[model samples]
Every structure is written in C-alpha cells, then in structure tokens.
Target: MTDAIKAIILGIIEGLTEFLPVSSTGHLVLAGDLLKFEGDTAVTFKIVIQLGAVLAVLLLYWKKYLHIGVNMLKMDFAKSKGLNAIHMFLAMIPALIVYLFFKDMIKTHLFGPEPVLIGLVAGAILMIFAARSRGTKTADTVDHLNYKQAFGIGLFQCLALWPGFSRSGSTISGGLLLGTSQKAAADFTFLISVPVMFGASLLDLYDSWDLLNSDALTLMLIGFVTSFVVALIEVVTFIKLIKRLRLEWFALYRFVIAALFYVIVIL
Candidate 1:
C-alpha cells in the first residue's frame, strides 16, 4: 500500500480508539508492523499525528478551558469552580514524571507487538476488576472530584506508560474505583489528556525534526488532519453516550482485539 493509504488507515484507527478504553498506541504498533511501516520515522509519525486528537479536544472544550484561564489570571478561585488548572496538574504530574524518567527505557524495550499484547491483556484485566469492584460513587461530575481523587487518577495513568495500556482505560478505571461516576471519569480523562498528549507530540516532533522532510511531513499532515476530523466526531458522540456505556464492554473488546492480534499477527 502507498504511504498515504497507510496514513489514512492509521489515522482512522487512532481517532476511533484514542478516546475509548482501547489502546491507540497498541493498534498503531500492530498496524505499522502489518503495513511494514516500522522504524524511527514511523514511530515519530505516529506520536506527532496524535496532535490531531489533541486539537479535537481543544475545540470541544475551549469554553471550559477559557473559563479556567480567565479565572486563573484574575486569581478568582471561587469563580473557577469545577475542573480547574489545579485538578489537571494533580491528574497529570504522576504520569509526566514516570514518562520523563523511563521513556527511553520504555521505547527501547516495550514499543513492540509482544509488549503491546501483554499491556492490552493486563489493562483489560484492570478494567474488568474496576468495573466489578467500583461501588458507591461519590463524584457524580468532574466538578465534584477532589484533589486526592485527581492525584489518584494520575497514579493510575502511570500504567499507560506501558505501550498497550490505554490512557483512557487506566484513568477512567481509576476514576471509577475512586468513586467517580462513568461520565465524570470520562470527562476528566478527556480533559486532562489534551495537554499531556499535545506536549508529548511536540516533544517527539522536536526530537525527530531532522527526520521530517517534505515527504514525511506530507504523510504526517495527512494523518493529522484525518485523525482530527474523525476524533472530533468520536469525542462528541462519546460524551453523549458515556453515561450509558459500561467499562466491562470495553474490557471485552480489549480482550478480543488482543487475542485476534496475537493469533493473526504475532503468531
């Protein structure tokens, strides 16, 4: 297949799975292996294209972000009620620290089909356990989450440093186990993900600047735009339906996808 075709396919997979409890990185790694699109350039392209999904989140939550920003500037904590900068910071620090410390080790050792398969199954098991054991949710909305809960979610997010452990899977399950409602957990997960993913993409792009010639830039742009459009639609629909959706359903999907990839590609 052509590079453009591969970009489009990967972009679609990233968009469709980025926000769901499914592992977008795992899918990309497996897809790249299948498409013979492995190597430094390919890895860089995958990470950079995630900016597309980040853009989608910004577009969807611009108002909330604006309110936080304005309130922060004015030093008006009371007015900046709900998911604020502090909450995001608390929810991001743990993963950021872990990623910074072990990123090189992780990239060298775990960015592969075998590690992704293990991560998928392990993440699935965590999701299943969270779904079964989560009881008496105390936070019904993002605004209701306490600092302790946000930090707890951040700790859970550290699991996503493992390639196939979905960030959303880890965070949302963490939120659930910590007493947040489904919609609340989903909202917090998506909100915190914007800065984290955007920063990671930019860092990866900076590191791979020399690799991004005209041809590679063209392919990355194609994937980027495709992922943005698809992710916007997915996020909007997901927000509407998240309250009704169950984590167990996504866990089942992770299990099925893991088995299929292991049988069809890894075997």
Candidate 2:
C-alpha cells in the first residue's frame, strides 16, 4: 500500500479503538498484516501516527490541561482544579517510570504479531468479566471521585502496556471497582489518557528522534488529521452509546473480533 493508504487505514483504526476497551495498536497491527505492510518502517509509521489520536484527546480537553498550569502561575494552587491537575501528574508517575524503563521492551517485545492474538483473547475475556461484575452503579462524574481512586485507576491503566489490553478498559474497570460511577470512570479514563498518550508519543519521538525526518513528519501529519476527524466522531458517538447502553455489547464485539482473528489470521 502507498503511504497515503496506510495513513487512512491506520487513522481509522486508531479513532475507532482508542476510546473502546480494545487496543488500537492491536487493530493497527492486524491491519498492517492484512495490508501486507508488516515491515519495521510500517510498524514505526503506525506507532508514530498515533500522535494524531492523542492530539484529539488533547484538543477535546485542552482547557483542563491549560488551566493546570495557569492556576499555578496565578498562585491559586489552593483551587480544586489545580489540585486535580496535581493528582493527574501523580497518577501518571507510575506509568512514566514503567514506560521509561520498559519502553523498548514493550515496543520490541509486547507489540508484535504473536502477542496481538494473545491480547485479543485475554482482553476479551477480561471485558466479559468487567461487564458481568459491573454494578448498577454509574461513574458518570469525575468530581465525585477522590485522588486515591484516580491513582488506582491510573495504576490499572498500566495494563495497556500488554498490547491487547485496552487502556480505557482497564482504567474504567478500575474506576468502577474503586466505586466510581460508570460515567465518571469513563470520563476520567478519557481525561487520564491525555497525559498517558501524549507522554508515550513524545517518548517514542525521543527514542526515535533520529528517524523522524521531513518525510516522517509529513506522514505523521496525515495520520493526525485522519485520526482527528474520526476520533471526534467516535468520542461523540461513544459518549452517547455508553450513556444509554451496556458495555457487555462491546465485549461481545471484542469476542467476535478476536475469534475471527484467531481463526483467519492467527491460526
């Protein structure tokens, strides 16, 4: 496939899976395999393009992050908003440490063709359990949650390092278990993703700075634009669906998709 085609496909995959409890990286890897684009360069391209999806999260929640610093400069650190920002960073520290130490291992070992299958099945099973165990409780508001709960959710967020496990899924499940309402869990999941994804993107660039020339820069832009449009749409739709439906249905999707991949691709 041409770089343009790769850009479009990867962007759509990222947008669709970024919010759901399915790993977008897994889907992108499968897409790459199917499209016959399974080389080191292609793999790097997909990872780099994910910068676009993270950008969507940042764009959608720019005010929260912006105010995190603005409140500090104003010496209004006593504000709850500023405190939330502090909690957010504190929560991020665990993943940052893990990422810093094992970044290469995750990229080199975890996110490969073999592990994609493993992630698909394992994550699907976990989602099934999450759906069943989830109480009638709805975590619809982040304000109701405490700092320790957010940090707990962030710790669960670390499971995404395992390739197929959805970061959103893990965090939401953690939030739910920690007594966050469903919506609160989901909202906090999205909010927490901003730092995690951006940090990963920057970290990737930092590690691969040598390979990111003008060509790579241009391709990353294409991916960012594509993922932005798709993710915005995804965010709007996902919010609506979760508000009115059960996550068990998405688990069903994870099962069927994973089953199909097992039979047709992995096997």
Candidate 3:
C-alpha cells in the first residue's frame, strides 16, 4: 500500500479507538509498529493527527460550547444551560500538570507496547469495577456533576498519561466509580478532552515543526482528514453505544487485545 493508504488505515484506527474505553494511543502504537511506521516521523504523525480527533469533539459539541462562551461573555453562568465551560477547564488541570512535567520522560521510556500492556490491564480492571456498580446510584447527566466531581475526574485522567490507560476510559470509569451515569461520564470526558488534545497536538506540532516537508505534509493531511471524518462517526456512535451497552464489553475487548499485544511485544 501507498504511504497515504497506510496513513488512512492508521487514521481509522485512531478514530475508532480514541473515544472508546479502548486506548487510541495503544492501538496507534501497535498498528503503526505493524505497519512499520516507527521513528520520529511516525511519532510526529501520531501526535499531530490527534488534532483531527479533537476537531471531531469540537464539531460535535459546538452548540454546547457556544452556549458556554456566550454565557461567559455575558457573565451569566446560569444561562449557559447545562454546559459549564469552567467545569471543563477545571477537569483539564491535573492532566495538564502531569503532561508538562513528564511528557518527555513518557515519550522516551514508556511509549511502547510493554507499558501499554500494563496500562491496558490496569485500566481494564478499573472499567470492570466501575461497570459492576453502574446504574445503582449515579448522576443522571453531565449537568449534575459538581466542581469536586469534575476535579476528581481530572485526577483520574492523569492515568491516561500512561498510553494504553486511555483518557476516556480513565475519566468515564472514574465517573462511574464516582456515581455519574455512563452518558454523563462520556459527555464530560468528551468535553474535557477538547482542550487537552488540542494543546497536546499543538505542542507536538511545535516540537516537530521541522519534519513538515511536502511529502510528509501530504501524508499528515490525509491522516488528519481521515481521522476527522472517522472520529466524527465514532464519537456519535460511541455515545449511543454507551447508552445501550455495558462498558464491561469494551473492557473485555481491551483485555483480549492487550494480551495479544503483550505476547507480540514480548516474543
């Protein structure tokens, strides 16, 4: 296959796994390695193209964001309806601090299949625990989550710094454990993800600015657009899936994938 085709495939994998309890970074790492997309350029491609997934979130939640923006401008938090921008900002704090201090360490030492395997299993356990106790006592929706809960979710999001742990998985599982409904957890997860992903992508772009030559740029564009479209579809479908299916299904899927990759990496 052509480089562009490979990029498309990776983009699809990214979109499909980004928001689910399954890890986007883990899938991308495994798929990229399988496709021989290693080295600096491949890493840059993976990090930069995440903007596409962030765009999907922005597009999907534009109305809610706009409401928050307008209300903030008018100094009327109550009029923002159920979408509070401050809550999302607060939820991003812990991850931001963790990423800034340890991003290089993480990229150098832990951005591999081994750490990913451990993270996958650890995160899966959390998902299973949360799934077992879902629905008995939970906040009905995102609007019901207080600042403390949002901050608590942010702390949980720090686990996603460990690649396969997954941002959505960590936050959603945290929400479930904290008594938030699945849909609410998902909504909050998606909301907080927008800023964090965008910031991380920007940092990656700045760090890898010299790598953006013509051919590389073309591949990046293809990957970006492909991921955007695919993520748009997946983001919508995942919300529906959360409403219909148990999160343990995703956790179980992660377990199988992690075990498979564990053997592949070790052997």
Instruction: Specify the highest-TM-score model's number.
Output: 1
Query: Residue 71 of candidate 1: its Cα lDDT?
Result: 74
TM-score of each: 0.96, 0.89, 0.93
Order of the predicted models by lDDT, top scorer first? 1, 3, 2
Quote the positional error of residue 192 for candidate 1 in Å.
0.6
lDDT of 2 by residue, 31-85 (tens): 7778776655565677776667777777787887787667656767555542366
> TM-score for model 1?
0.96
Give the per-residue lDDT digits (tens) of candidate 1, residues 1-267: 999999999999888889888889889998998999888889888887888999999999999889778877887765666777788888889987887778778777888899999999999999888888748988999999988999999999999988899999999899989999878888899899888888777777887798889999999999999999999999987866655678788888888989999998877
Off by over 4 Å in 3: 78-81, 134-138
Which 10-residue window in model 3 sums to the lowest lDDT? 77-86
Per-residue lDDT for 197-240 in model 3, tens only?
A: 88877877787788779998898899899899999998887778
The 10-residue segment of model 1 with minimum total lDDT is 237-246
What is the TM-score (0 to 1) of candidate 3?
0.93
Error of 1 at 242 (Å): 3.3
RMSD of 2: 2.4
When summed lDDT is taken over every stretch of 10 residues in candidate 2, the lowest stretch is 77-86
What is residue 66's positional error in candidate 1, in angstroms? 0.7
